[model samples]
Target: MNSLDTTRIRSYFDFPAAGRVVTNNAASTQPPRELIGLLQRCAPWYENVHRGQSTASRRTTAMYEASFDTIAAWLNAPGRGCIATYRNTTEAINAVMYSLLTDFRDGDNVVTTMLEHNSNYVPWHALCREILPRLGRRVELRLARFDATGRLDLDHLASLVDKRTKLVCCTGASNFFGTKPDLSKIRAIADAGGYPQPTGERRALLLVDAAQLAPTSALDVQALDVDYLAFSFHKMLAPFGVGVLYAKRHLLDHALPFLYGGDMIADGGVTTETVAWNDLPWKYTAGTPNILGVIASAQALRLLLDMVMPTAFFGGSGPLPRVAIEEVMARVGRHTANLTARCMAGLSEIKNLRVYGPEHRTPLVSFTIDGISPFAIAEALDRRGIEARAGCHCATLAHRALGLDPPATCRLSFALYNTPDDVDLATDAVRETVAGRRRAGRPRPGRAQVSTAAGRPT
Candidate 1:
């Protein structure tokens, strides 16, 4: 059963009235109506932040700046200096790649897992396979494997890290497999790899793509001891635009700016001979940011707390107590976990289907029927008013590594708002879809085929 009053939480969204069951939450969670209202609430005073002299600018700037604190507090980071916003998690991770580009020595390597979403894997791939090589650096990229049960092979991960390993990029939760690695254990392995940093630290830096974890769990960056962590606001009930990257304060202080332009420079500190960079975060924020989006994303977190709990503990702007965050997110984690368990149980009952990942997953299920096309399953589910996602879910590397011919699967990922009823509807759709395909023995044009079979699949 869900830990929160899901019926009441459903009231905060518009999907219920519209009869839309959004089970594809790993791609993006539905934004609450209140987040839209929050954006409307900021419409009047919305102005360029840090660049204007007007009162509206200062007011909007305060809200924008305060957004970072909310994000930092949500992750239990040291302070706002560690936070940097981007267009999405993909961009946020790419920023890390660029900022650390020059630091990679010729003989260095990066250790990442095959279970990573492309957002985490592709950036490192390009850094090692494409970009760094073009610059005359032959930095190697090593992939740690996941077992058939979808858990990261910690032993395999350990074997890949050594003194030459510079960074270890991992996914906190797998979008396709729904596996969650032991982050603390991963940290221990990363630290065991004694790479000499320019900062004199003898360890491989750790970067976690928290895209799946952040939406449901309360995370403590200090506790994880990760050097870099990235996640998208869209996965957590905010609008589609903003993503975040959290680094240690010293790292941000030392790394080069990802994108350099107008606002990132210190005021009048730019001379023709010497250009000064702006302080902590704005040094990373190059131009006019998604000011309204940042404010709304922060407000989304506040609204989330009020939705899950009995009281309004967070507001528009104030210090967000870590205790409050831990409480609210624990409820969210429990609710989603129950929904995922229900999904897994329902999917298990569907005949001739293979569900990926371990029993304890991060609120998602990806599976394939023996003879049905995954895309067709998604299409059939959509026709039933049950939203589902098909394709690799950008976990192309994992899908390919698993020996999937076309490298895809139909995925049903849950959130705090998902209900037991939603899981039934999704699995029922899949069961019926597979049954329908079986009845029609021959391949039809423009439809799913049991490509390996001449007739109906048993």
Candidate 2:
């Protein structure tokens, strides 16, 4: 199954066998069975990496290190040296925050936007509001606004960045709105801030939380020219537990390690008076890492390629071809985009249901009905065997910005394996749920029949 072949692609996963509708992919993609098997196979030989001399140890270490290379190629980064794995995107973003702790001077501000997931916003909030202030260095956290249509206010974002702005953080895609911001334009705005760095560059550093974008999009860090980028593998059909942080080599070389011990130290370079950190990527990787998760996550990317291409990549390892990567992701994007549109069209017919964001969105639709709680809607969908996510989706700020009374919405997100039928089912499920609510309450006979759409199958 290539990117366009959902029938073949869905075969690799166990979800279809179970007759499930997995529309909450923005939270996490269901793992394909081969990855689980690959993970299980590593159990017998699993050994602590980079510290032992045994054959099993060396083998694990080699595969572990090569996973970095695969991740780098996936992002079109310079090399493995730029990739650092973490538990998830949240921790990866926190890593950057800790690494830059002392870099913020008094009165300096970090400008982020209202569309951020709490993973992106909370860390900066704690850093500037809690951590830095107590240490007698007061840094400010500024939020740029988004419009009623869920489009980011780019002009407002630019105005938020000035000489005092040390870094600008933004989401590449909104998990709630499903809106993908123009990263190149955001990069230009960040550069225009022109905050002088210690390295002599005159620009505020830009960090992107790409948790929502990386699944279907081909993310080229070089092309984006972002200083730092973070994304989680769980959202990309890889099993949970691994995320990646891509920083410019120079920034990694200069910044202090967020966590220090074990492998992060230079092999024999630790001394009482002086200590040397390891090379580019490892300098940031401290302690015994999530070995199996990293390796399997890398293979997950390979499996994605194999699903999209006539040939296979999961059977092999190392750098993926850039052209193939681009083609595969574009195909996946187009497929999911079509599915989202279809889902929206089916959803639009329902009375009192309102979808968020502009017409063009990522592979997700978040919406709410006037009289129903989103949580209640999600529970009703669950009874129908459909998987939908409710509440803020960790985008509390975006919800609050929209003046959502309870600050929540029901969201249906898609992946490569999601079918048009799945979208229709989810949308129909929402319609039925809304119709059910009307029947239980004070029902208008005419609107009730219309809402329930008795002509359609329940």
Candidate 3:
């Protein structure tokens, strides 16, 4: 087994696990000491940024801008690309969707995949709704289907993407299945399909929601050749209320701002009120912005990068490409394999347990027992000192796609810090709960009933 120093990671998170299994990385990650220290150091400088003319405000503003530069370097975005700060991934998605809808005429279609997070799915779908009525032309929306293995159907995806498609929104990785779509292939498809004369044919702009990929792995924006990318720092072990939306500066120059406010408005007249927008990123990023959160997020990015540097994470002697996600996943797969083995072994002892998602999937496993509801399973595990996520983890459409309606299954996600022992403990708890229910010959009291929703399992 490829060993990970999970004890060290647990120490870093300061996990207060008196006992039982630990399984709570999917919701949010724990920031390291350095990031926490960075936040604490700047906590006192909470003056209003961009609004104040004072030196304190100036310092904060400078720091905030510097944070953007740091993030750009971390993402390896184009030198002139704009990194507009935002509230979260949802806001970033909104900005991009607004930009696309404002620029493109009606009847222009958006091609996305089933693997996308709701943040990526909702905005574009809403945009389609808004624009479809304006012109007689209908807005076409398509979802690239995934195979039974939960991997993207690349051939089908390519077939769906055509000249009418104005934008292709894809995720860097799936939060549900922990499947990293082959971005290199997606980029190739985009390059082949995108507009006019240069690369033989023109197609659609590729926008990647890197919310899941960026924190866990490095990205090369140029190499990917995507038109736009968005991610959140909160999921990357940074403080909340800070996310990034990166687009080629030229493209951003043409797009309309999603919101209009202080920092984004150049000037406005008092009379009938005429207003001019700011330049590039600042045009989209309205108001004072999340200065402290930005700074802290930058620190958080550095912390995660340091921990999973290409050399250490990838397990090779020669220098690994910092932005190669496949290499990282290959390494992570090794980690997952170890955990999976332990989990499967322990789960084998249990009767009537149904694990969801792809078999031989990542460390994450969404499952249900024959007679128990997801909530009961989560509660049972919680009482046993193990924590897991239950319910339709925000991907309502994904659940529907899986043919599961109403409440979802229990989702146990693993982090780099999670150990085989944790998996064993979790499996033990699950087995014990199943056995208890079976022996009692009755449904456990307070246990929830099976969901009546109608989506297929992914």
Candidate 4:
């Protein structure tokens, strides 16, 4: 298989010039210089959307609203009416929780997995434990466990769902485990549960947290048959502060809005007697939205394809070819997979280093050296100019389930811009850090006393 032209891709990012080895892509990818430039280009047309009659407001509104179309096309949703913007993946998932707050019956339940990030898990936890109980509802939140190798236990998940299950929320890819659950099988399980919803459906609604998956995969909400999907643009190449929630047309049409205020109401229809909501998507967009962020996030999707392939697709609008999207993402997935494999191979050679997740998984590896704190490992890697992340990575449940003392692991994740050499440098740094610790006697106790020596643990 051919590799991506990472040299050309690296040139588009400013991080390479600063001697930074950005391997923490699963957390957030570095924005390309062109994306930053695009933001500046929009400065001339600065105004709030859906407000005044001035040319600036009209132009900004057009661009901002068109952004919804671009995002819908990227996800292969039916249309822009199915899309709603949010601050991030956490907020997007919260929106779903709030929208269906009253719809959940007293005896109903929500089924999620141990492989989820807190963004997907915490909201349901709060709904079942804190919020709903206070409202005199006894909604149960069931958690499905993972296998010994860090894969989602399908049988365990199937056993958790029943007729009373209202929703099944799962992550498209696990941030800590790097495991991608088979969505089709999950959809089937959800359907077989025969849960009755207010919308006359007999199956539990499927909500996929695609935060980690969307950055490196081709996501089609229609093909997956997911009722709701959420992902953040910062994980891809876009700037921060923009996330998306794609729901079926009927759901958005019938489900209550998450927030209500200004623009969500119909034009001049806010009478004292009764207030009518706006159209499909506008009804979801309350207040003056993040106009510039939405536009930039849509453009980021275009720029991602252009960055992967040699052809230019930026500064355009309309539906992207599914074939083009698949081909580009396939190339990206293969490249990152190869880099991750190399890192795993190198890390496995080091003594007492325990790597989490399956050997073949997403383009990331989380591991810990025995007797060494992951925080110290991250700091040592930082001194060596390798940007990696440590902690539960918002995957607190999975880490605790694995019996990790501090519930943390040091993670090195890859992206399209990361080359094979970057993987080598990172793994080599880990080996050195571990070896230095062995030479310096036993590991020390406490956080402040941990060693920062290259290849050494505190």
Model 2 / residue 390 / CA error / Å: 0.8
lDDT of 2 at 87: 95
Q: Give the TM-score of candidate 1.
A: 0.95
Model 3 vs. true fold: TM? 0.83
Q: Which residues of candidate 1, in runs, are more than 4 Å off? A: 313-315, 442-458
lDDT by residue for model 1 (27-95), tens = 999999988887888789878999989999999898899999888888889889999999999999999
Q: What lDDT is reached at residue 45 by model 4?
A: 80
lDDT of 2 by residue, 376-396 (tens): 999999999899989999999
User: lDDT score of model 4?
Assistant: 0.92
- What lDDT is reached at residue 122 by model 3? 79
Ranking by lDDT: 4, 2, 1, 3
Clashing pairs in 1: none
Clashes of each: 0, 0, 13, 6
* Model 3 alpha-carbon drift over 4 Å, by segment: 1-4, 17-22, 134-137, 192-201, 266-276, 306-349, 359-363, 442-458
- How do the residues 97-215 of candidate 4 rate in per-residue lDDT, one tens digit apiece? 99999998888999999999999999999999999999999999999999988999999999999999999999999999899999999999999999878888899999999999998
Best lDDT among the predictions, by candidate number: 4
lDDT for each candidate structure: 0.90, 0.91, 0.70, 0.92
Q: Give model 2's TM-score versus the native structure.
A: 0.95
